[model samples]
Structure formats: structure tokens, C-alpha cells
Target: MHKTLSSKQLIINEALRLGFSDIGFSTVEHLAENEIHLKEWLDNGFHAGMSYMENHFEKRINPALLVEGSTTVVSVLLNYKPKLEQSDPEAPKLARYAYGKDYHFVIKDKLQLLFDYIKSDIYPDLEGRMFTDSAPVLDRAWAVNSGLGWIGKNTNLIHKKLGSFVLIGELIINMEIEPDTPIKEACGGCTRCIDACPTKALIGPYQLDSNKCISYLTIEHREEIPEEFKGKFENWAFGCDICQEACPWNWKARPTSENEFQPHPDLLQMTNDQWHNLDEDRFTELFRKSAVKRTKYKGLKRNLDFLKKK
Candidate 1:
């Protein structure tokens, strides 16, 4: 057994062993280019009610500011594509990513293991923080900078081999490492994602207006859904996957091996009537560890009511 390996190889092997689909490295630096796009998006009120997007503006653009002394950014991907979907087509739909346990818990655990490995096995003095959609990290931007994939027209990080059905995470460390180069954009004029957005949320290629996004409306928006957009949700009661489902690259996505990512048996068998009749106790029982809990019972019931309205 090779007891010692280069820092890069050690990190890659450890990440893969921890079930990460792929990993890439980049030097920690200011994301000046993405800053302009982010500022424009915020200025356009595209973030809607997610005020956190406006917080930590400087840290979001420059990772070094978020993690002092960090000189390398390790980006990782975890595939969550489901092998099975909700059985009842008429049941209010959920984004495939929400089929099972909350990803923040699952991915963060594995990231902690990786962090421990770096300290115990590779570098005893290492210090950093790992994030998986829980912080102000520019995940997609860093993933692109790490050369794992290109930002698709839909603004998803599309890996050539893994498609867009994956979650991205990051580990920023103080150790400098060789960085990867960005991949070329491959959307090639495809407008399927934009054309498929029922609410016209994908205002244009690479641009999204969260105020009109189903995922944002059902999961993040606290107020009553706008009446103008009634009947356009396409039956989605939780997060939506219309954009990823419409993308060509997603056709190549494979089922995830992580058991935690598989749908609960109850989730698969739920009928429209069952969802309509769901009570708080049942909601808590089923979604105790699921990302679907993000919307909570009241929010979910709101979505159901909107979908079933006459």
C-alpha cells in the first residue's frame, strides 16, 4: 500500500473513496468576472426575497476573504440522479434531488471526513472550511474555475460525463495546489431549457429570474403565490426540475449509488389524494430528514392548494 502520495492525488483519491463523483482544484482568487454578473443579477431584483444573496457580497466574489490563508479550492460533485421517481404521475411532483434525505446533511458529513483525512493523512497543519450550498460560496463559479464542468445555458454546471444532475460542494484549504482549466461551453444554441420553463423564468440563456422560478416560489417564497402564475406550476409542489429535465446534457445522467439519495418508498407511492390530505404529523413523519422539509407543512399545503384550485 502506498502510504504517501502527492497532496493533489491524495485529495482526489480520498474524495472518490468518500463517494464523490469527481473533484477538481483551483487556486483561491477573487472571482472578478462573476462579480459583475452577480451584481447585475442582484441589482435586477432577480434574487427575489432571498436577502441572503445580498449579504457577504465581498466574500462571495473572493473566497480568500471567506477563508483566510486559503490558497486552494477543491471542488467536488456528488450525483443525486434518482433511479426511481414518484409512481403516481398525478401526484404533485418533487425535484428528483429531494427524493430522499436532505443533501446538506449527507454531503457535509462526507466533506468532514475528507477534511479529517487531509489533516491526519496528508497535512497535519491544514485549516479550512467545507461548504455545500450552506454558505455564500459561489459554488458553480468555483466548480467552473476548477475545470470540473462548464456553466450550461441554464446556468448549471454541466460536467461532460456526469451531466447536470449533481450537487456541487467545496473544500477551501491553505495549501496551494496545481489548478485545473475551465472547460468550453457546449450548449451550442440549444434553447430547450429556456423554452421549457413554464413560467418563463429562464429569461435568457445563462440568466434566471427567481421571482418567476417554480423552485423559488415553492421552496423559498414566504408569501402567497401570485395568482397571475396560477396553473403554470405544472403540478410541482416542492422543488422543480423542468430546466434540468429539458436540457440535452441531462439525458446522459445516471442513477445515484448513494442510498441516502433514493426516494422513500412512501414518497414513491403517494397518490394525489394522499398528498392533498397530508396533515402536519404525516408531513413531519415523512420529511423528517428530507429536503422537502425546507418548505414546511404550511408551505407545502399552500402549493397543493394552488395546484388543486378550480
Candidate 2:
């Protein structure tokens, strides 16, 4: 005779079969501690031009506001680690996450499928919505609250077994489920991420200064790259993975299993001179399905010019 599985266990099992690396649940409670951290990060102007961060003060901390009668937040970590990175040592480097198709679309599709499959169950009033790196959700906080992993010194969710290369998604539903115990910080006294930053972006243990972060200037900022960061970007033309690269937890990260997340051949094989002379046509053809499209043609040119100047 088979034992009856709880709703939470059934959900977790299904999420795994669907290819998520980790699935943990959190009660829909106010995140007071997280709110304070957000306030401090914003007050210090660490969020930079992203004013939207200040708009959803209440909704971010309280899932009750986002969904009615929300009791459980099913947080899932889908690995987006690319199968290949820029091969040429001197080729302007792209962030690992951007090497493949845009994760917002990839992960959101998976989340919706999970939602539909769960809805297929006989529960009459199973209400839920899937969220993946969009909206006002504080993904890292929710992932931590869901006991998926601890927020590392670089402010990324770091799993003991999977590292920080995971993409977080959530399914907030009205069903009751047992929540997992929160993971403790495994970073200890190690400051390799802090020490390895070329721009000193990590201002403190877990705090970062976005204005100085290479990832921010390259991808988030709208105007010219700040003169102060001129020589500090170290040729990174997109998001920075320096912190994660320095974290010891990454040693346990197996290469991603998702085919859609593999790097485009043209992107992976670009020579240094090719990247230096990359034009609109090649950029579009190569990154047509990747997250690098977020930067647009102009943004990529802007980043490339900045790298050239450096």
C-alpha cells in the first residue's frame, strides 16, 4: 500500500519532475526584517535609477496584499546556468545568465505549467498566480523565507548544493502546506566575493553600492557610463558574475540541464576583435532569443564603447 503524500510533498515532487532544482514553501507573512533592509538600501540611493523599487512598499513585504487568502508561497529555483560562456579570453564577457534565452520567458512558462498542473487537481477553489523576476516581488527574500537558500554576501540566494546560479519563481496559493526550515548563511568569514570585486561594489558584508557595480552601469543605467567606473568594469559588457565566481558554493554547481538555456554558437565563438567591432546586425542575430536584448541595440553599443574606452 502506498502512503498518502501531503499537499506540500506532492507539490514538491511535481515541481522536481518538471525540472526545478529546489522547491520550498513559506507562510504568507509580513517580511518586517526584509522591509528594513530594503528601506536602507533605497535610502542610501543604492537602487539608482530604478525608482519602481520605491513604489511597492507594502505589497512587497506582504503577500496578503498581492493575493487574497494567501497562505503558502511555493518558491522554486530553476537553474539558468548556461552550457557555455564566452570562449575567447579577451572577448568582451557576457553574464552567464544572459547567454541563453531570456529567463523571464523561460521560467515564467515553467511556472505557468506548474500552476496549470496543480489546478488540474480536484480542489474546487485552488487560487494562485505565478511570479518570475517581474512585478514587485522581492525574489531573494521570498526564496530565503521559503527556506530555499540563504541570501549570500553578494545578496544572491545561495544553495549549499546548487550555488547561486538558480532563478527563483513563486506560486502563491490558498492551500495550506508545511513550510521548510530556513537555511542558515554558509558564507561564514569568507570574503572572497567582497575582495574579488573590481569595482568595490560590495560596500559591506551583504550590502552593495549599485552606482559602483559593473553590472548596474552596464545593464541598468540609462545614460553614459559614469566616468568613475571607466577603468573598473574590467571589460564586462553585461551583468557581472564576479561575486558568484568567487563564492565557494559554486563548486557544487553542476552545469544547467536546460537545453533552451544554452549559449548561441555565434556568441560563444566571438573573437576579441569581433566583439570589439560587433554591430547591430550581429548583436541582433546572436542575441535574438537571449536576455541581452533587454539592453537593446543602443545599450549594448553603449556598454561595448565603455569597455573599449577602458
Candidates in order: C-alpha RMSD to true structure: 1.9, 1.9
Name the TM-score of candidate 1.
0.97
Worst 10 residues of 1 by lDDT: 1-10
Q: Where does candidate 1 stray beyond 4 Å? A: 1-5
Against the unseen true structure, what C-alpha lDDT does each candidate score? 0.92, 0.85
TM-score of each: 0.97, 0.96
Residue by residue across 20-103, what tens digits does model 1's lDDT show? 999998989999999999999999999999999999999999989999999999999999999888889899999888989999
Cα shift from native, residue 140, model 2 (Å): 0.9
TM-score of 2: 0.96
Candidate 2 lDDT by residue in tens digits, 55-153: 878998898898879888989998877656678999888889998899888888888877877778634478978898887788888899888889888
Please report the candidate that would top TM-score against the real structure.
1
Candidate No. with top lDDT: 1
lDDT of 1 at 226: 96
